[model samples]
Target: MTHGLHYTVNCSILLTDLPLLERPAAARSAGFDAVEFWWPFPEAVPSDAEVEGFVKAIEDAGVRLTGLNLAAGDMPAGDRGLVSWPGREKELRDNVDVVVEIGKRLGCRTFNALYGNRIDGVAPERQDEIAVANLAHAAHAVGTFGGQIVVEPVSGIEAYPLKTAADAVAVLDRVGADNVRLLADFYHLAVNGDDVPAVIAAHTGRVGHVQIADAPGRGAPGTGDLPLADWLGAIEAAGYAGLVGLEYKAAADPFAWLRG
Candidate 1:
C-alpha cells in the first residue's frame, strides 16, 4: 500500500487538531517516524525561546524532521512567499540562518521555498529577477549544511505563480544551482491542470521531494478523483527515491487511509 516509497507526515497541514508543540509526539504515536512542516512561527524570525521550544518538541518526540519551509510571508494574510517580494529580502535572508540551524539540529536536509504572489506595483519580470537571486542566496547558505532547497507550485491563489512542474523547473534552471530542485505535489499539480504522470516522467531527475493530497476537496486520498496510487507508482517507477509528504486537510481521521 505504501508503493515502496518512504512517507513523512506534514505536521503543518495534518494533525492540526492538536497544539503545534504536541503534534510531533502525536505523529509518533500514530506510528510515523519522520515529519515535515511549514514555518511554525508567526513571523520570519522568532524569539530564541520560541526556537528552543520548537526544537525541543521534535527532539523529545524522537521523530526525524524530513522537510521544512523557509519563512514565506504571512500565509493567513494571503501572502504566499517573500523570495520574490522586493522589500523583504533582509527578512528572507535572516530567516535562512534560523532554518539552516534548525535543519542542522534535526537532521533535515530538504527545504521548501515558496514563490511569492505578484504585486500590482511590481513588474512580473522584476519579480522573476528577484526570485532567482534570492533563491540562489538561500541555496548557497543551506548548501553549507549539505541542505537542498525545493520550490513548489501551489493552487488556490491566483496571484501566486509557479502552477506547474514546468514553471517550477524553469525557475530552478534560472537559479542554476545544483542544490535547488522542484517539489512535485500531486494535489497542486493536478489542481492547477498539469498532467501528473507526464510531469513525473519528464521531471523526475529534478524532483527533490514529493507531496500528496486528493484533488477537488484537498482531502485524504480516497475523497477525491485523483488516481493517487497509479501516480505514486509512476513516481517510484520513474526513480524518485524520497519521502512522500502527506499534506492534506482531514475531514475526520487523517490516518484512516493508513489503517486501510
Candidate 2:
C-alpha cells in the first residue's frame, strides 16, 4: 500500500500512452498488483474475440482486476452513460451480463455505472424514472455473482446531472437496491464543489468505491492543489478500506507520486 492506502492504477485514464491491451502489463511492471478500468470497448457489447483478448491481457499481466466500469455509452464521443438516457435502456442492460462475465473471470466485484446526461426534450422526471429502473436491473444482474454496482457523480459535463455525492446517493436511494452504492470520485466531487472531507466523514458507509486525482487539473496528485493525502487519511479514519483508484491524466511518469 502507498501512503497507508491500497492504490490501484486506473489503466483506462492513466496509461494512455500505450495501446489498451498493453496497459495492464505496464501497470504490473510499475509494481501495482491491482488495476481497474473503464469499459475498454467501443460498443456496449463487443465481439467474443474482443472480450477474450481483454481478459487474456489482464490474466497474462499477472495483476488483479479490482474494479471495472460498465459500458458508459461512447465515452470519447461524450456519451457519459446510458442508465438515464431515454431510449438506450437495452444497451445498458445488454452490457451488464458482459461486465459480470468479465468480472467473474477476473475476480472484480465492483462496477461503476455512469448516470447518463440529461437530454433536451426529455422530461427530467421521465429520465430519472428510467435511471432508477435500469440501475436496479444492473444491480440484480451483478448481485447474482455477489458483485456490487456503483453510481458515480461526474464532472466537466454540464448535461451530466449527478454532480455531487448527494446527487448520486439520491439516485441510489431511489433505485432502492441493496447492492447499488456510490462511487466517490474525489476529483469529480471537488471539481463540482463538494465538501470533500465532509463527504468522506458522512458517506463512507454508503461508498462502494473511491477514486482520486487532483482538481484544477485532473493531473497527478501534486500537480494540482487538492489535499489528496489528507482526504485519503480522512477516508481511512472513517473506516473505508477499499482500494483508492488513481484515476488521473498522467503528466510524465504517473508512478512518480508513489515513488516520491
Candidate 3:
C-alpha cells in the first residue's frame, strides 16, 4: 500500500463561504498542500487582476492548486448540473474555459466535470450520449493545457444519472479520452450506499481525484462514522496517487479544528 497524504483546499470551506482573498492562507494554515475551488472566476464576478492575485496567494503559500469544479453555473436554483441544461452549451463551454485558464494560472491541472439536472423527457441513453459528448469536448478543451477533465458523480440531491463510480467509468469509456477520469467522492459513495474502498479499488484504472466528507453531515474527516483512515489506506493501496480533497464543513474554525 502507498503511504503519503496530500490535502486539498476545497472551495466549500476555503472559498465558497469565505471571501476569495482569505482562502489560500486559510488553507495553508489548515495544513493543506493544495487547493481546489468550485468555480473561482465567474464572468460577472471579479477582474483578471483579482483572480491572478488569488493565484499568487496560493503560490506564495506554497500550496499546489490542484483542481476546480468547472460546473457551478447550471445549478443556479436546484436540480441543475452540466449535461442537463439544453441550450446553455456555449455559455457552459465558455465558463469552463475561463476557469481552465484561471486554474492554469494558479498551478492547477484538473477541471471537474459535473452533470447537471435531469432534463424532462430525455432518454437515459440520450443523456449518456450528451454526457459523453460534453465530457469529450471539455476534456479536449483542457487537454491543450495538460489539464485533466475530472468527471464527478454525485449521490446527494445533486445526483441525477451519472451518480456512481461505475457509471462515471462508462462515461469515461464513451468519452474515450486519456485526459478524462473519475472523481470518487466519499460522501456520494456513502449516501449512494456504495462501499467506498471497493469502488475506489474497482475504478483504480481511471480514478483521478478523491474527496472525503462525513456521511449525512458533510463534516470533517474524523467526524463521521465512516472509516476514513482505513478507506484512505485502501485508496492508496489500490494505486490512486492523486489528491484527496477535504470537501467538508468545519463544526468550528477550520484551521483551529485541524490544529487540535
**Which candidate leads in TM-score?**
1
> Mind giving the per-residue lDDT tens digits that candidate 2 earns over 115-171?
899999999999999999999998998898899999999999999999999999899
C-alpha lDDT score of every prediction, in listed order: 0.94, 0.91, 0.73
**Model 2 Cα displacement at 123 (Å)?**
0.6
Q: Once model 3 is optimally superposed onto the true structure by TM-score, how far is the C-alpha of residue 13 displaced, in angstroms? A: 2.9
| Candidate 1: pairs in clash | none
Instruction: Please give, for residues 62-131, the per-residue lDDT of candidate 3 as tens digits.
Output: 7787877775563546644565466766766776667667766776788887777666786766766776
lDDT of 1 by residue, 161-252 (tens): 89999999999999999999999999999999999999998999999999999988999999899999899999898998999999999966
Q: Of 1 and 3, which scores higher on lDDT?
A: 1
Q: What is the lDDT of residue 257 in candidate 3?
A: 42
Top lDDT prediction, candidate number: 1
The C-alpha TM-scores of every prediction are: 0.98, 0.97, 0.88
Off by over 4 Å in 3: 1-3, 14-17, 41-50, 74-76, 255-260
What TM-score should be assigned to candidate 2?
A: 0.97
